[model samples]
Target: MKMKISCKPIAAAAALLLGGCMVGPDYHRPQVNVPATYSELPGWTQAQPADADAPKGAWWTGFNDPLLNELEPQVAVSNQTVAQDYANYQEALAEVKVARSALFPTIGVTGSGTRQRASAGSTSSSFTRSVGSGAQIVNSGSLEGNVSWDLDLWGSVRRTIEENSATAQASEATLANATLSEQIALATAVIDLRTSDANIDLLQATVKAYEHFLEVVSNQDKYGTVAPSDVVTARTQLENARASLIALGIARAQNAHAIAVLVGKNPEELNIPHSAAMPTLPTVPVGVPSTILQRRPDIATAERQMAAENATIGIAVAAYYPTVSLSALDGFTQSPLGGLLHVANYVWSLGGSATETIFDGGERSGEVAAAKANYQAAVANYRGTVLTAFEDVENDLSGLRILAEQADALDTAVRDATHGTEIAFNEYQAGTVDYTTVATAQATQLADQQTALSVQQSRLLDAASLIGDLGGGWSDSQLHDPRNPDKPPAQPAAASAASAPAAQTSSATGQGAQPAVQ
Candidate 1:
């Protein structure tokens, strides 16, 4: 003979799985009102299109500074902020795994062995009568296994996993943002240090020139060709130049401290040589503005956060439906230890249960409202980030253009000062002008040279700032780039090369077409 089993449970599970649909509005990228072209302004040149296929990783390498290219990776590997974000990303991934596991059944095993004496009038005494004993001692042992599952009839488990997976992606973006930030900081700090050093050199040369002038005045005073008061005035000018040199050292030290922090080292452990390592500004290609949405890690992070929030709305809505659970157990039991193992001693049970929240003083409604509010907040934040990113790129563009013009003007000033000094020296040698006139002209010449150096440094810094604001040419490849989270690692050579702007053009601008985030 054959026994028949019902297929009702299997059919029901299949129906639930097939019928379930996630509830919530699917994510839609917000439509932003962007300009066709950046507004024309004084001293501003239009940005040119960059090559789409060119590598945009390790943008700092475009400066062609071997030391900076070497140090950039170290900042990404060991920077404390990047490490924290990397750990958070791992934790989010683990949460996704945990959430995904909820779609399956849970199984547990239990076993017990016991010996007991029964009283004469106890319920077990009736069964003992068949064994011919007034009072009986029983030995019992049993092993049981149970299975429980909550069928995702409404896709609750699937929705939960969806929410967590989006969170994990957001965490990954955050890590990339942190890495990009560290790289930018290190590059900018290095630029600042170099600029400071150049300024110091300029001031040192000025101080030496002033010292020589002071000596000339003192010698002339002894010969009565110059007054004693003139000698004092010259000494005072020399002291002022020395003071300026001392002040420049203070800024340089501070910049060095900042660089140490960027590289994840103690200030005392860092020692940059006094070489003229000023970075050369690269001709950056302006990709489309729409690429900023995909290229900037922070913007990507904001977009992912919106996706997670959207999923949360579904999770909250799921709470309004009834929860169904199925449980089953199978085992054996008997009065004697040996009998418990017999085939006839088998016992089994299966059941289903459900629970619904009929009333909770409006608590469920309130919870749903809160979830909706959270979703709205996330949307607003994402939009705000998009706007801010646009502003930063535009501001940097204007700064670079205006500074270039200023640098040109300063170069002219240096040329004129050099010519004036030559003319003054010739007149003084012919006794047509006094030594005081030549001294004044020489001082003017020194000031103009110093100003020119300062302007050039500013221009370099402005260029670095522009690159940093544009995300340092960080590419999507480095989004998953495996740098040691615990310590800074060197950027790859391929990334460095790819980061260079494709073509040198004065009329280039970031591209205007937007890319999809998902």
Candidate 2:
């Protein structure tokens, strides 16, 4: 018997599969309401293109603190949180390759050898049928190769690839966000440590002044020129001053420990010597609110998450279509172990099959609806992230503006209080006033000085926070796609346009339009 097979039907089906329609909504970034300008921008200094002193490289360098500059860079490399995010990003990148592998065919090879003993009288079809009753040995060998492909006629594999790629980009943005946050934390800790040092110096000076006042009061009490209560009051004031100076050590040590951890070190490993220098407050440039969309890494992370969720909808919609699969097998088989590769023993087959679900109890519909709802949620989250970024920037700007005015007032009050304290002490020595007046004046001077130092610390803290809220020199354009990590990342506008739903309509060759990446 001879069998004849026709390839025309399979070829025609392949053409139809290639030109099949991908039934689902393509991804488009949802519209968002963005403000034209920030409400707190009025008092902030706007950066000019030609300003030579504007912060150029790392924003932390603008503070001009040698220790901060040295420590801040280490956060990106050594901070445990940042290292964990980086590892997650690498895993996401590998997942993209895993998803893309579904787009191509799978190839496999198999080889086998078999030997068996069979009774000769079992089923004889030879010329001398039913002549022999003894057992016979048979040897057989086979080798085969197969190729199978689950054709992506409805763009399911393409959608899966798109989803994984977007996830990878989101993970990359997450890594950036983590690094920026740790760096900001490091800068803030250093500022606190320096403020503690400054406070310690101020308190030490006040303690010395209090001791001198105590000495003068004790001498007068011994000569009967002052009341015995005056000696008690003087000793009480000096002891209180000493106690306040000792309390400052707690804050300074805690701040140092926090800085060490921020830079990925143990508290005991890093020893920060007492520095007389304070960090200079840097002028953070406030741009229009729209710029935050591109500058903030958290916003970028949210946007990429939206794109990934959008692709999931397409994947779910694909399940509604029938699945088509193509397969091919080629090999040689022989009854004996000799000449297995001969043309007489060659065998080949080409086949294709399609399966359509007749009944699924509405499972497919539920999946599609769930995917769409998830995408909508992602869109809402993205918009919320953007709104929150604007809020952060506005709050930082307002705090800095008001704190600057308060700093000036405190400076003037400190000088006047110092002069008042000197006059009160002289009046007490000349017997024109009681020792109580001297004690009150000294307390006022110390209070005013401490308030001034506190105001300075607040201003420096606000500067660091403002810089961080401004994105700490990060940009969305730095988010690299895993597929082409060496190439520059596409701009947000261009990437959105490329993956727009309107542009996706024309592609049906199982090669859907993809998100833009350089």
Candidate 3:
């Protein structure tokens, strides 16, 4: 008998396996128009395609900053945003497991024993007759087990699993994106702090020059060689230069505080160097725009969301189909203690059921429509993200190019300003020019130096933006592979193992390009 029952379950499972088919429109990545080369920038060099399996991790190391390299990994493990997304990804994974569990049978066991007493005068004389002259006691015991399973006739459970799995993948991508963003912020803050220090140094030098001019003017006025008005102008210039130095300190302090936060330290704990240590901006390899589909985490996240929405449509459509279920109960029951273990007291039941919703007030149809609409919205968002990514990279490229040219021009200006100041000082000492002329030349020199520093900082920021927009050379293998969908996801250990060979290849070939920064 047990064999017969098992046969029915086996046959049902086989039928279900053969009949199941994933419904709804399958997900296919939307076609995007991509240019072979960026047209917005002239003389842009494209990176040659390397071996498909190459390690690009720790792209930040190209900057050669030991501190930054050490801090980068902490973002993935400890940053609040990344931690939150990791929790979300785990939750989605559990949901997928929950949905998949519905495909199997559920078994439950129950046992009970009871005793009851009846009063003699509780009923009519017939009830008394049934109980007999003396008090009668009745006792019963039973143990039972039930098995139930829902036959997924329309693939609803499968679709649910699919949707949840895709959502989990999206959450994983979110974690990666958060890490990328934090690293970029850390690098930018560091560069800004250094720029501030450089500017302050320039301002300090200017203030000293102004003080010297004020002393010279005072001497000339005492000797009646210069008017009182000229002395007043010299004093005012010195005061203004001092004020400028104070203002520069404000920004430098704020930038230092920002860096402290990024490194997971308190502002008071941070001790950045007072002098400038200019960061190097690495030369980024601009790959093809088509590669953007796989490289950018936000873009990958959008694509995964689309997959989830597509699966939801299938789930909604399945609501129109009937549901089938099988149930069975087996047990033994006896009224007497001696008969409790007898086979004659055994009881069993088995059944199957089918349910079909005849009317739903158009709710099911509305659900299907909503799912379709959501899928369309996801597709639009994905395209927009891709376009935005392209624009960001191109914009940074243009910025770096123009800033490079500006820095060159500023270099020449600083040299010319220094020469003018020297000549002006010589003439002032010879009594051919007023003290005011020397002060003006000194101010010009300071402004030129500060401007040059500002341009360098801008160049560094643009470099950071370019690296970020290009996804920091992140590999597609971290997310999904379009070429081999059946391959299991690369675990951390597996990823590390795979990356080793690529690292070796990169080292051997010397194909690794450093960041372009001075």
Candidate 4:
């Protein structure tokens, strides 16, 4: 009958072990819209899904610029912004370790020593004691250890660990996003500087042509063949051209300073030499629109946040159930040091307790409600982020297309303007046109040349922006996922713009080439 009574507690423990199920809803990837092919990508073949397994392509190399190759890698190593994100990732990694510790029992030790004397007249439990040497000296010592464990019968600890792991994964995505942002920024700044250099070159050449025109005008005035005002107009045009040429230095200097800061150098520490050849625009082969979710860090971040929020629901639900606590104590005591290790002095005990929240004024209910609301919000945010990413890629594709057409038309205008300038100069020599006419033609030619150069600059900038909009080669896999990597297999080249169908694309895979610019 006593054995039958003891079996009851064992039956309860068995029930607890078998009945455990995580209380909250398990995470499932939220449904969101993903387009078939980019509306802006006309006449281009979409890469098959198998292509995503190809190496993540190097988009910057598509530009074919040597200088960019040298500068872009520096942002990862020395840039302060990237460094800050790296440190943040490390902190998240540490937090994962912290959350995991709850799964194990905790141990503590205690020790004490004491000395005392008992009165000679004392009695033991009302029984008379004979006086021995007037008083008896006594000494005692102890060493003890205790163990306690909060059994995860309700899955609270498991839920907490899941929450932390998801949060850490989100942090990893943020770091990748920051690092990519800075790299693209540095690349854009360099493009701007190169553009400025090209424009300055154009203006300087105009200045030289204006100087020659001024010489011809002065000779005519000396011979009294043209009026004094004619000489004054040519002199003004030459001076204006020189002023414009010199003013461009300000922009060039400032852009150089900006590049210096990006690479973690002082403003004056770096200098880029003038190069006439701009990097060739790589045809950015924007594969299909569906893959963008795999490579985008911001999107990855949002999805992870949703996952983290989902775990909190389980944690809140667990709070409504009882918590099981188990503890054990073991110690040794002796009057003399020699007897401390003997089993005769051993002391031990084991016990288990359970606590239930019978009433809490609806606090637990409110908490559960709040957790659900937060999860819903995260889902909305994740969907919104996906939409925004698709829009970004589309914008870049459209921009590059239009800019290319504009560049061709401007090239024709510059050539016609040059012809007009030559004809006006020949008319002046024949004395059929005044110096003012030649000056006007010269200004028109300079203006057209400047416009053409600016278009070239614009084309380069749009290309760089396209690369940025496409995710700059970052993968979702780079983040820490101890139990399972959330992202897809490494993206094929140019997949920095990659996204997975099931929210499993890595943030750091796919070093393959990007979409080609048409």
If both were scored by lDDT, which would come out higher, candidate 2 or candidate 3?
2
Q: What lDDT tens digits, residue by residue, belong to model 1 across residues 331-431?
A: 77666566566678777789899999998898878877888898889889988988898788677666656666566687888888878877975675455
- In model 2, pairs of residues that clash are none
CA displacement after TM-score superposition, residue 25 of candidate 4 (Å): 0.9
2 or 4: which has the higher TM-score?
A: 2
Candidate 4 lDDT, tens digit per residue, 223-328? 9999899889999998988888788889988888888888889987897888776677655445567667766888998999999999999999999998988877
Ranking by lDDT: 2, 4, 3, 1
lDDT of 3 at 409: 94
> Which scores greater on lDDT, model 1 or model 2?
2
In model 1, the runs with Cα more than 4 Å from the true position are 1-19, 40-55, 115-138, 422-451, 475-518
Residues 1-518, candidate 2: write the lDDT tens digits: 11122356545765675566666787888878888776654322333221234453488887889998899888888899999999999999999989877866777788899876667754332322232457666667888887787998998887887889899989998998888888888888888899899988988898899889989999999899999999999999999888988999999999999999988999999999999898887656555577678778899899999999998988999998889898888888876656778878888888999999989999999999999999989999999998888888777766765676676688888898999999999999999999999999999999988888787778778777767776776778778877676788765453322221100111233544221100
TM-score of 1: 0.82
- For each candidate, the alpha-carbon lDDT, in order, equals 0.69, 0.78, 0.73, 0.74
Q: Would you give me the overall lDDT of model 4? A: 0.74
Better of 1 and 4 by TM-score: 4
Best by TM-score: 2
Task: Output the lDDT of residue 367, model 4.
Answer: 95
Q: What is the TM-score of each candidate against the true structure?
A: 0.82, 0.87, 0.84, 0.84
